[model samples]
Target: YSIFMCLLMSCISGIGRATALALARCGANVTAVTRTQTDLDSLVQECPSISPVCVDLADWDATDAALQNIGTIDLLVNNAARTSLQPFLEVTQDQFDQTFSVNVKSVLHVSQIVARGMKARGSGGSIVNVSSQASQCALRDHAVYCASKGAVDTLTKVMALELGPFQIRVNAVNPTVVMTEMGHLAWSDPEKSKKMTSRIPLGRFAEVEDVVNTILFLLSDKSNMINGITLPVDGGFLAC
Candidate 1:
């Protein structure tokens, strides 16, 4: 039973934690990455099978060092994104930069680093970038967040095309609002939750399992032919 190093940029909570547990359940030795050592420690206990690594994905040197420690990765999940919800007029330069730095640049750094090892071994791998349904549809007060994810969706296609020759498949999973710890905080108010749920044709936010199943499919050989596509696990949010 050979181990697969699952490169996860998001660590302790939210979708990242779900992804870590999902990969571990599938028998992969997950190398979870995060900014805070405290968060990493929590993750280590949350998903005991996963090996947590503390690294600021936005920092080039730190990310590079973290990847070096992993040596080789069988699959890279670019699931690190920061969302800033504000009206277009109220957006700041710092917000724009931070969103791009994490959502876009960090994906580049991790993918490039992991691809080298995957390519050198002549045994290709898979990359699953976590995009947002906002990339496919418009929402109020999500300009910067949308743009950042839009870039991720585009980057997924580009990587798929470029890495195809090496047999490495790249795909994006665009999920709608997931019911995580963060979701409770974000949509705590009943009015907001109800309004948001009504927008989805399914009348509910996505569950951790919804996105996790889709991610596992993309990572597995089951989706070998499915490349360069943004599979929206949005529960009919994009349809309506």
Candidate 2:
């Protein structure tokens, strides 16, 4: 079976990179849409299954045009986002707009473009939006990031509700701090890391494979009846 997976990930970062590479290794054709080609240099060379498309998700027309002719998409991961670490009072208008544009707007726009294909062709598909626990729990300086992910969770439900008739499944994966380069950089501080990990029963951050495996499952036929739910891969953090 031909599997077309679209990963509109967070600027070629940990979860996106790991998921794309894993999918490629599994022999799935991947279309990785990024805002810049510079971030995808090594990834493209390493994975022959990935076809990189640099389209600014902040621009609606550009996103539509870029993904329009990508053929049928059987799986879609709306991992697009721009995180801004600023206090409530310190967040700027530009930062808020840019964050929402990439985080929330892009997720909706890109899903629409891909879902049309899945719907028109009468092929059932799965869409997994990469979300976070921050959507449910507020972080110190993640006011905007948390809000955007919350929006994603809501969107997942709406998509699941409307697309169920067409055999389309929509869901979200909310993971805890993952140990990617970016994750390590952000949580490298011992005090900060401990503070966060202490809250998680797993007592540590997640590896990239943890989230990737979840995404792969959600996209496969194994999850045929699962829809409109936010699955947390936080190593039991959310359970606490």
Candidate 3:
């Protein structure tokens, strides 16, 4: 059984690395997709068990071809995304275009490609799209990012409904201020981190493990009855 882990940018580090290790520990062969060959090499070194595929998700044709060669993914985790923080007034069209293309279109394209193989396999497979609390909530300087993720949240339900006949489950895991390397950069300052954490009932930033655990549950048979849902692993941030 093979699992395709679609990670962008720095896959060798951060939440991607942690998730790769988690899958490897389960004896599932992981196929990691990223933009840089150097980073792919590092991923191979870090998780010797993983198969690295260097590709730019922004390039639709390349992404499709890459998945075609891999063939029959039992599990697909679409976690590749980029966030741009700019005030509404200052945001450029290029920024909005790139954010939506990467965050929304990429996920749609990969899911469609992989779902075909899963349907042919008969028994079916599962997909977990990485969403964000920003999808449903308003945040400063995140107009484009929030809009893109909001589309993802809606798409998750649509895919679940359409793919349910094939027994292929589709779901999303939404996190709030997760402490990934990239996330740390966004809220690195102690004061900024504190202000964000204070809003969460849990009083802490979301850990990678928290989101990963939720995705693992959805991927596992335990969530068999669960579909078309965006479960927030956001430390009750959404509730508040």
Candidate 4:
């Protein structure tokens, strides 16, 4: 039997790196789409199963051209996003545009490109979009970020509805503050972190594996019946 191959594109954050490594460990050939060649080189070193396609997802033409060459895709993850922390009234136009460009537009572009391949191949596939708990709940200084994730959740549902007949599953994974390097940097202050963690029934932020495991489940046949749902790996944060 041939090994399963999954094309996973992330913004090369800690979650993306961990997810890529885990997929490789499971014996899937991983093609990582990232903008930073430095992160790409380091990730490829960490896991030889990964191949690199360096393209800034914000560039529609470059991303389209790049993915056009990836051949076949059995699974896809749209994990690229950008955010600026500011009050709704303080948010600038550039901040809003940049956030939407990467957070919302890229998801549509990448998914469309990959889904076309899946549909044409007729082998079916799974798509997981990394969203956030902020999409469901209001957070201070997260107006733009929250709005973009909400778009992703809606996109997930619509994709699932439209693609189900083609046997392609689409879902979104919404996680609370994950303790990645970036996560830690953003939430390392004990006072700030506690405010958020206290609301979670789990009483702690998520680890990298928490999100990765969920993505793996969605990609595997174990979740064959699941589609269009935004599954939260946030330790019950959204429930509160």
Candidate 5:
């Protein structure tokens, strides 16, 4: 199957890179979309099988045009997002717009584009939106981030309801404090890390592979019946 994945930030690191490599290893032809040529080069170096497309998802028009070129894909993963950690009152208009544009609007636009192709092909397809645990629970300094993810959760349900007749499965994966480079730096403080991990029954942050595995499952036929749910890969943080 052909897989199309969008990773807004650096393509060489984080969930996007891991997902691309994993999918390629599974023998699926993977097309990775990102914003930087440098990161695209790095991703190609890491996995020569991945086809890289450079397009800024923040630009709706450009993203739409780029999606048209990708043709029809069997699977789509909207993993691109912009996060701003600031007090609700301190968030600037630009910051809010930027965050929503990348996190929410892009998902809507890209999914529409891809879903149309899926419908045209007369075959089923899977879409996975990378969400966050912040959507369901409150977190300090995550007002906008939480709000964006909340929108994603709602969108997933609506999309599933509308697209299920066409044999399209839509779902979201909500992960908490994944141990990416940025994740480790953000929670590097011993006190903060301990306090956060203490709340999770697993007592540890998630690794990229954890998120990748869940995504793979959701994309695969194993989750054929699952639709419109935001499955949490949060190390049981929400259980507390």
Candidate 6:
């Protein structure tokens, strides 16, 4: 584990930040990538073991350039995503493009770059794409976001198929609403929260640690046989 090298995207906050910190604690040499310098600085200050790389993942050219500099990575977490909530008819082209750029295109680019390195090294690697349950279950006002995540899910399957031969494993984690700061705000209304929770068999929203732990399991040798699947950390929301 101490020898594990992990490159995590969107480590500025939320599930990304939690994953980065947990990885560092597990003795992985973590490279935390995010867009803001201040947040990167804060992450490093909080966990000095993490090496921060600041780059806007939405910018394809810049993201590719930045990732090129980071040498061989054993594990990669494509956790950067943009969600634009709008009705199908109200969704603008910019919103659709932006959502796909961050959620789908960026993941494809980063995974391609990292998987190449893994193949070259001949050691193989694990890649986890942070997708949403919305990809499978539709929600109102989430047309564009859901489409982008659906693309991500499809891309993950294709990547897994192609890379499995190289001993590379690719998977996506689709979680129900996790109680992050933003999650709390978005689902703050008690009635809304209750309605949502009633659907989940677990009777509550996912915690950041719940998702982080699943991610760690996927990255570990324990899940070596698992590949080409999207594991839902949704408290069985999809089951119902």
Best by TM-score: 5
TM-score against native, each model: 0.93, 0.95, 0.96, 0.94, 0.98, 0.95
Candidate 1 lDDT at 169 equals 95
Global Cα RMSD, each model? 1.9, 1.5, 1.2, 2.2, 0.9, 1.9
lDDT of each: 0.82, 0.84, 0.88, 0.84, 0.92, 0.85
RMSD to the native, candidate 1? Answer: 1.9
Lowest summed lDDT window (length 10), candidate 4: 1-10
Model 6 off-target regions past 4 Å? 1-12
Candidate 6 versus the native: TM-score?
Answer: 0.95
The candidate, 4 or 5, that scores higher on lDDT is 5
Question: What is the alpha-carbon lDDT for the whole of candidate 2?
Answer: 0.84
Candidate 2: list runs displaced more than 4 Å.
Answer: 1-13
Model 3 misplaced regions, further than 4 Å? none
Worst 10 residues of 2 by lDDT: 1-10
CA error at residue 120 for candidate 4, angstroms: 0.7
Instruction: State how far residue 78 of model 6 sits from its true place (Å).
Output: 0.5
Superposition TM-score, candidate 3 onto the true structure: 0.96
Q: Which prediction has the highest lDDT against the true structure?
A: 5
**Candidates ranked by TM-score:** 5, 3, 6, 2, 4, 1
What is the clash count for each candidate, in the order shown? 0, 0, 0, 0, 0, 0
The pairs that clash in candidate 6 are: none
Better of 1 and 5 by lDDT: 5
Off by over 4 Å in 1: 1-10
TM value for model 4? 0.94
Tens digits of lDDT, candidate 6, 1-240: 322222334445589889888998888888877787887888899999888787887788898788787876899888888776788889999988888888888888888888898899889889988898999998999998888888989999999999999999999899999988889889999998999999999899999999999888898888999998999999999999
